[model samples]
Target chain A: MARFGMVIDTKKCVGCQDCVIACKTENKVPEGHDRDWIVTESHGKFPDILMEIRTERCNHCSNTPCVSCCPTGASHIHDVGGVVLVNHDLCIGCKACVESCPYDARFIHPDGYADKCTFCIHRVEKGLKPACVEVCPTYCMHFGDLDDPNSEVSKLLQSRKYHVNLPEAGTQPNIFYLI
Target chain B: MHEIFTTRNNPYVDPIMAMWEWQIPVYLFLGGMVAGMMIIAGYFLFSGRHKESNCACFSIPFTSLILLSLGMFALFLDLAHKPYVWRLYTTFQLKSPMSWGAWILILVYPALIANILIRPSQWMINRVPKLSEIAGKIQQHHILIRNIGILNMLFGLMLGAYTGVLLSTLGSRPLWNTSLLWVLFLVSGLSAAAAYVHLVAKNKAESELLAKADNGFLVVELFVFVMMFLGLLSSAKPHIEAANLLLNGAYAPIFWVFVIGMGIVIPLIIQLLAVNHKVKHTPIAPIMVIVGGLILRFVIVSAGQYSHWFNAHFH
Candidate 1:
């Protein structure tokens, strides 16, 4: 019943995209489609400009519109850590989940079914970190159970100032960025 | 006074890309039109108009059944996993609008089929002699026929509203996230159906009556649309921006020129004149309404796609 979550440090992230490449290879995401990517944001004038580089993927929301909108229950929350996953066989490729995702996380796979980051549930179940988290060269990404107060993610969230993307969206996104 | 620049190059989700193409709009249009046909046919049947040789109910329901099947085919084509399309009927998710839509669509068949049984076609009766007996038996049972009419109208209303409610359920798309969308689509479908019935119904009195009804539906549809625009405009920044897509943004020209002008205003004027007996009823007006309904679907769906929830971090 653990609620798994990810915490990324915005200041430390260099946007190297090693995590993106690692995820594509680990998940075997089709060529031209990506399960994870990076975003670089900058603001302010000339000499006082500021930039924050962040890697992004599915937020694995607690209140997921993707699962709620899925007609066939093809998209679901995992029993173990509440990771969002898609049942490829049950999917009708309707794209209802794709359109409903506020994160713009879900996409229709080239082969048909809606696909997106699963938090590497397969790996998470095997007692390992998600491929993206494991391959972060800067050691900027952290993953652990959000429900467990003793977990690394919980500790970091408690001790650091952080923000979740699109808080107004009300998805209750699990991904947190330490500002 | 801070400036920010954040971007991603994902071709699918970024840059206001819509995963759905022409198939979705076409399906909605056909679905909405069929919905309109069924309700009109249902009302006529309830009024016991089938006894008259020139009544539209006897023919329109039959035609709507086929068109509903066509619309389902369009829906099937839009599915990414076509082979697994049957999964929709496997287990229904109560919270899902798509699930509700799937069940509503399936139930529509029985309503349409029972309406057909109220008066079986000659060829059908000829092919299966028992069909004549069955039709006759069903016709004599006034209660069952009326119930069938009620079912047709019920399903028709569900089908019509579901088309827009489906999109409205997607809160991510601000343009479609409105309480008024279902009403707008339902009225538009009704108007389109009335226009079509007006165009083809041989019953002169009924056709003229429907022509007037179409005008009323068109005005109500215009009102619903304005309410939807005002609803979006009065909301958050993203929603206001979403409304602008059809108001002043890239989607404006087609929405105003085609959907509002040619689709509603022009057709309503023509139908008004025709109903008043000022001008002979031309096929042009009805056709415009039908085409306008189709374009309305296209515009709402396409414009809604361009309106996504703003990603604060992604810009």
Candidate 2:
């Protein structure tokens, strides 16, 4: 019942992309592939400008369209903590899951399978944080079990005004950005 | 609100390069054509149109088997893990369109075989004496032949609709997310198949009947297409942009000239003329329909990928 999630404080993010490099290194995601990235938005005119920087990745939704669309069940949810992962051995590389994903989070790995952010389940299993969360210098990223009321991610959701990427998509994304 | 969101151009994550290429569109076109053929053949068999049924049954099964194999091969080439392709057969997922499509395609083969058995060719009976006996047994049981025809029609309908459902299930691509997509694909497939059969049928009556049928399908296809565009235009901003991509954007030339003009309009006019005895039947219109069908798949697949949420959100 433990739903793992992330809370990113956009106000604190610097758009440095260190988290991106960390994810690539940790996941060995290949030269031209990524597990996470940053999106920057600029609002208002030059005299009155508001620049917003936020890092993004797979939302790991409660209702994952990728999992629903995958023919081979290669894209599945990890039972332990509700983490979404792809079994490359079972993936036919049809790219159905890749297309179904509203976040554009999933990618076809060069070795031939659907690949996406795993929320570093490999590290989380070892009682450690994801590479992106660990490497973010500004500490803008927070990851924990959202189901646990005591967890930092849950507390952040209670304390902050946050918005998900695409509410209309109906995926119920776990990644929240603090306004 | 003048707000600008910029997504960094990262080919690594953006899916800017289409994962599906020429192979997918080719597979879709062939699959749709086969499905359309089966439905037409099945209808002829059930209606007791012996000459028409013979013409259709002669070519449908064998051609479908060959085309299905080629289409599967094309799909295999597109797989990153080609060796693991058998995993698609291991289990069934009700939620997955690809899973449904895989199962439907498997069922199509058996239905096609049954159809072939119901009416074996002279060459086939001559080559395999045992097949003649099987064909005789199958032909005697009118109920069995009727059942096969029904199965073929059902599977054909499923196959045709599934092609569009496959793309429409992709929620991220606004262009492919329409409810009308499956209907459009089904009508287009029927139209293409009718045109194809009209070209190949030896009997003038059958050929003319199919041409008339093709005209009906073409009209419905045009209407469904317009509905799809209008539906998308009325939805969210991203969906509107996706529609605009076909209406007047980068894909406008292909959408307007090829899919609408050459594919639907020109073929409709030609078929209408042929139906009215205004002009002699020519292969040009049927050939145009098939080509137009193929191009439609390619453009839809390509343009759907191009109509991404991030692209619309950022730009």
Candidate 3:
């Protein structure tokens, strides 16, 4: 009954992209495809601009359009922690899930399966942090059960002023960013 | 100036989901065209035109079988996981338009085949001797023919609307978000079919009749186009950007010239002239309508893929 999510401190990210590399290497994502990426957003005038560094991936929303739009039920939520995962064997590679994702998270793998970051469930299940979470030089990313009040992700979200991306989308995304 | 830069670079989702290309559009056009054929044939059947010496419905059903199969082949080609195509039939996904389409597509086959057996051609029976027996058996049950006609029309409606709904259901693309696309594509399909029947039907009366229907459909399709454009332009920033892609972006020339000017407007004018007996009916007008229908699918599919969520900085 665990709900997994991420809480990242954009103030401390430093835009290093180590997490991006760690994800690619850990997942063995095919050439020319990255399951996750970094975004450097800046706002306000030059002298007073505030910049934020974000490492983004599949939000694993509570109501996922990708899963709903999948014709073959190839995309489903894992029972372990509500992680969205794709069953490559059943996938027809119609790319419907790819088009339905608002976060622009998924891509059709070269081998013809829709793919995205799995939240490193293999590591997460083994009581190890996701590769990206483990490799962040500044300890900016934290992964834990968002549903547990005692989980680090829940505590971080409770203690900080945070927001999820694309609130207007209403997907109720699990990932939270500390402003 | 507020600015945002992302290092996301997957080919399928760099700026948008560009994986759907010409193959998907071709399949949609053919599906729409087949939808048109089945509906027209069913209408003829319902009106007792099937009893006529040489009703266009007789020939249309036969051609629809081939055309629909060809369209399915195009869809098959677009499947990245070709080996697993049958997986579509394993489950009926209530939320997926494609699942609805897959089931509808299969149902269409039986409807079409039944229509063909309603009056199988002598030439076909000569080639396939067993067709005679099957045709005789089917013709025995008058009620079945009526049911087949209804099935054809029902499936045709779904097929035509499904093409647009297919694109519309994918909320990620701002360009395909509007429900008007369903009505737009259905009217376009009907117009395209009417034009095609006008050109190819053996009966001059039927041809003339379809010419008029095509004119009406063309008018509606034009209105739908305007509504779709206005709907997108009036929405959120991403939709406006998507509409601009057709209005004045790289796709503007093709969208304006080929889809609107040549496909809908010009053909409607010519058919209007021909219908008034002011000019002889030439193959040019109908051909333009058919080609226009195709080009519409292409423009929608390609432009839709290029449309993205608003840039974070701009937002």
Sort every candidate by lDDT, greatest first: 3, 1, 2
TM-score of each: 0.97, 0.96, 0.97
Tens-digit per-residue lDDT, B199-223, candidate 3? 8989889999999999999999989
lDDT of each: 0.89, 0.86, 0.89
Candidate 3: lDDT of B40? 94
Ranking 2 against 3 by DockQ, winner: 3
Off by over 4 Å in 3: B311-315
Expressed as tens digits, the lDDT of each residue in A63-151 for candidate 2 is 99999998999899999689999998899888888778877787877788888899999999999999999999999999999999999
**Is 2 or 3 the stronger prediction by lDDT?**
3
Q: Is the docking of candidate 2 incorrect, acceptable, medium or high quality?
A: medium
**CA shift of B191, model 2, Å:** 0.7
Residue A41 in candidate 1 has what lDDT? 71
Assess candidate 3 and give its TM-score to the true structure. Answer: 0.97
In model 1, pairs of residues that clash are none
Indicate the docking level reached by candidate 1.
medium
